[model samples]
Target: MMNPFELERYFARWEFTAPFLLSASDTEPLAMSELLRLASPEMSDAWANLSLGYTESTGHPLLRQAIADLYTQTASDEGGEPPHAISSDDVLVFSCAEEAIYVSMRALLKPGDHVVCLWPSYQSLYDVARSIGADVTLVELREEAGWAVSASEIEYAIQKNTRLVIINAPHNPTGSMPDHDTWRTIVKTVEGSGAILFTDEVYRLLEHGDAVPLNAAATSSPRAISLGSVSKAFGLAGVRIGWIATRDAAIFRSLETYKDYTTICASAPAEILAIIALTNWSSIVSGQEAIVTANLKLWEAFMSDHESLFRWVRPTGGSVGFPQWLGEGSVDEFAENAVQEAGVMVLPSSVFRHGNPRVAMTNNFRVGLGRKSFPTALDRLGSHVRARYG
Candidate 1:
C-alpha cells in the first residue's frame, strides 16, 4: 500500500492562490542577487565562471567540510573547543532536507520493523517510515510541560524489535526543543536500546535566546544520523542543498546507492551558492535572527491582545510554532473559511498531531515568525481571528 496522503498539503494547496501566507516554514528567502551581496570577492569570482556539469553524488568536498564545521561551532561557540566530532566523510548532501529524509528512510528500513517517533512531527518523519512497512509508535511532547519530550515515555514506546528512533528538536509546529540535559538523557536512552537514531535537525541553526542547541552530530553511538540544510536558517530554500551526517560508513554507502536512484546529485550551482552561504554563516544568520526577534515582539503583542481567542507555547528557536486557536466552529472549517474570507494561510494542527485523544492536539495552528512580511501577515491573521472566533 502507498503511504497516507500528507495532511499539511491540504492547507498548502491554497498557497499560490492565497494573498498572505503566515504558515511558511522557511524564513524570507534570499534572491541570487541578495546572496551575491554576501559573497566574498573570491566566491563572487567563482560564481562568475560556474560549471553546470554533474557533481559528485555524495557532495562536493569543500561543501561537505563546511557542514561539518557548523556542527563543530555548535558545541564550541559556548566555549573554546577543537575540531568537530563528525568528519566531512560523514556528510552526504541532498537536493533539500526533505530529500535527505526520503533517501535515508528508503535505504535503511525493512518490512515489519518498528519505529518510534515524536508526535506532531513533520508528517514525513513517521509517514514515510510507516510507508516502508514499519510499525510506528509516537512519543508525545507535553504542551503543559513546555513542549518537551519525556525520555521515560520514549523508553516506554519502543518495542523490543524497534529498529529506529527519530528525534526532531527545535521541533516544527510548537518549536519545542530539549535542553542539553534532556538531550543527553535521550541520547543515552536511544543508545542503550541500540536503535539507530534518525535526527531531523533541519531547524538546528535557528537557535535564539537561552536556546541550548544540541549536536546530534556529536552522537557517540555510531548509529545516529543527523539531517540538516540551509533552507530554514540561511533562507536559501530555492538553492535546495541539504545533507545527512552519519559516522556509520555502511549507512552512508547505502544512502549513496539510494540517492542515485532518486535525485542522484544536488544541482551544481546550488552547491556553489551553499558554500558561499556557509563561508558567511554567522553574518547571514545574525541578520535573519534579527528579523525573527523583531517579528517575535509583534507575535508577543498580538498573542497578548487575543489571549481569549488563541494561546501558544512560545518557541525557543526555529521559524514555526503550534498555537491553540480557540474558535467556536470546526477548526478545519475555520482554516478553510479563513483562507476564503481573510486571504491568510496557516496550517491547522490536525496536519501534525498524531496520538491518542488525551494527547492528540486539536484546535491549534502553525505560524512562522521569520517572514519579512510577518507584521502585515499578523494583522491579516488578527482580523480573521477576531471576526471569526470572537
Candidate 2:
C-alpha cells in the first residue's frame, strides 16, 4: 500500500518554538499523582489491590459504565434517555482515541471506497482513509467564515460511492465549531446519503463560549460513529483511554474483530486510572478549563496589539486556534526565523496541508493556549513579527 507522508506529520518533525502558535498539542498533561490523590479515601487501599493482567477486550465494566453515563442526556435519576444510552456491547476502548480511529478506518473501509473529510483537520483522518485505498475528498472550511464548513459543500462532495464522512468539531487547527443549525444540516445530509459519519469529539468539552449541545452521532443514527477520549479535554493523555461509540452492530463487530489483530485490549493499569479520572471528571475538567480561560485572556490581549501583522478568528472551542501571519514572506521563513531568534515554536499553516506554497505564503498558523506562560510567548512572537515585517 503506497501512502504519502501526512503533511502535518512531516512539519511536526521540524520543531521550533514561539508564542501565538497553533499546533495539535496541549499544555503539560495532568500529573498522574494528582489524579491518584483524588481517588476516594476508601478506594486508596483498593488501588493497591488492582490486579495487573490483560483487561477485557471490550473494556473494564466500571470504565465502560462511567463512559456511558457521560452520554446519558438526563441526570441518572431523572431517567431521560441516559446521555446516549448505548449498551456496553456498543463500546470498544482502545490504547487511545487514535487507535480507535485507526481500527475503525481499517475495518469499515475497503479499497476504492470514497470518504469525505474536513480539510486542515487532524491528518490521521485523511491519511488513514487514503492508506486504506479510499478516495478521500477534503471539504475546505472558509477562514472568512470562522473556518466553518458549509453543509451544502458537504452534500455536493458526497457521491454514491462515498462511504464515510469524517468531521472534528471544535476542530484542531481552527477551533471552529458548527452551530446547531449547521450540525442539523450535516447530520441530515449524512442520513440522506447513507454514508457513515465519523465524528471526532475528543475536544468537544473545550468550547470557549456557549456551545450548542450535540449528542454523539452514534445516538442520532445507526450510521454515525463518535470518537472520544480523555486526552484533549480532560488533560489525561497518559491514561490513553479512547473509545468508539456506535449503534451499528456491524461496525461494532468488525472493529472488535480487527482489534484482535491490532491491540487485543487496552492496558489494565491504564483502564483503572481512566476510571478514577472519569469519576473525578468534574474537578479535573474544571481545573483545565480555568487554565484555558486564563490563557485565552492573555492571547486576546496579545492579538489586540499586533492586529496589523496577524489576523485571528478567535477560537470558539478547543485549546488550539489558527491565526494567519499576513506577512510578506513565507510562514516557514517566519517560523524558522522566530524559532532561531526567539526560542519558541509555532506550527506553520502549510504543515496542515493547506498546500506547500499556501503553507509558505499563507499567513495561517496554529497556536496552543495550554502552554505555560503562553502570554509571554505571544509577546515574544509579536516582537519578532514586528521586527521582521513591520
Candidate 3:
C-alpha cells in the first residue's frame, strides 16, 4: 500500500509557541488564577468540597446554559426561543479548539471529498482536510480589500463534489469580518449545495469596532455548523472547553456519536471553571477588550509610519492583523534573514500555503498586538523591514 504518512508529516513541523512566534495567536490566554479568585467567594467552599471525576459527555448543564446565553436568539426574553432552545443535547465539549476541529473533520469528511477553505487561514483547516484525502481548494482573500472574500467568488468555486465550505471570521491572519449583506450572500450560496458551512467564530467576541454578535451558521441555516471556544475572547484556553452549536439535529446526533470515540467527556474542574467564567463573561470580555484596544493603537501608529515598506489593512475585529511586506527583495528571504539575524519571529505568509516570489504572494506577516512585548517587537520588525526594503 502506498503510505500517506509522508505527506502528513510536514504538518507537525510548525510550532505556534513562544520564541517561535512573533504573533502568538493564543498567547494572551486568560489567567485561570484570576478567574478562580473572582469566583472564590462564591465557590471557594464548594470547590474545596467537590470531587474530581468525569463530567457529562454533553457538558454540565450550567456550562451549557452559560454558553447558550451568548447566542442572540437563545436568550430567555426571546420567549420564541427558550434559554437552552438550541440543541444542547449533543453538545460535546473538547479539550481545546484544535481537538474539536480534528474530531469534527474526521466525523464529517471522507476521502476524495471536495472542500473550499479561505487561504492564509489557520493551517489545520487546510492540512487536516488534505490529510483525510479531501481535495482542498484555497480561495484567496483580496489584498486590496483588506483580505476580505466575496460571495460571488465563493459561488464560483463550488464544484459538483464540494462537500464543505469553511470560514474563520474575525479571521485569524487578516481579522476581516463580513458585513451582514455579505454573510447573507454567503449563506444563500451554500444553502442547497449539499455542502455544510463550518464557521469558526473563536474570536467573535473580540470585535475591534461595532461588529455584530457572533453568527452561528447553524442558527441561520440547516447546513451550518458553528464552532466557539472560551480560549480567544475569554482568555480561557486553559479550560480547554469548546463546543459546536447547531440546529441541525442530524449533525448534532452524528457528532454526539463521534464524541464517544474521542474524549468521551470534559473534565469536571474545567467545566466548573468555564461555567464560572461564562457567568461573568461581560466583565472578562471588557478587560480583554481594553488590552486589545490599547495595543491596537500602538500597532496602528507603527504601521502608519512605515507605509513605504509595509502595508496594513486595519483589522475590523480580532487580536491579529496580517500586513503585507512590499519589500524590494524576496518576502520569505526577508523573513528568514530577519528572524535569523534579528531574533524576532513573525510568520511568513507562505506557511499559510500562499506562494511567494522573491516577494511571497502570501508575503504578509501576522502582528499580535495583545502581547506585552508586542510594541517592542513591532519596533524590531519595523526596523528590519525598513533596513531591508526601504
Q: What is the lDDT of candidate 3?
A: 0.73
lDDT of each: 0.82, 0.77, 0.73
Query: What TM-score would every model get versus the actual structure?
Result: 0.94, 0.90, 0.86
Best by TM-score: 1
lDDT of each residue in 272-349, candidate 1, tens digit only: 899999878888888888888898889889989988777888898888888887767656677787788999887777
Off by over 4 Å in 1: 76-84, 218-220, 353-360
Winner by lDDT: 1
lDDT over C-alpha atoms for residue 329 of model 3:
65
Evaluation by lDDT, superior candidate among 2 and 3: 2
Q: After superposition, how far is residue 209 of candidate 1 from its true place, in Å?
A: 1.0
Q: TM-score for model 2?
A: 0.90
The ten-residue window of minimal lDDT in model 1 covers 75-84
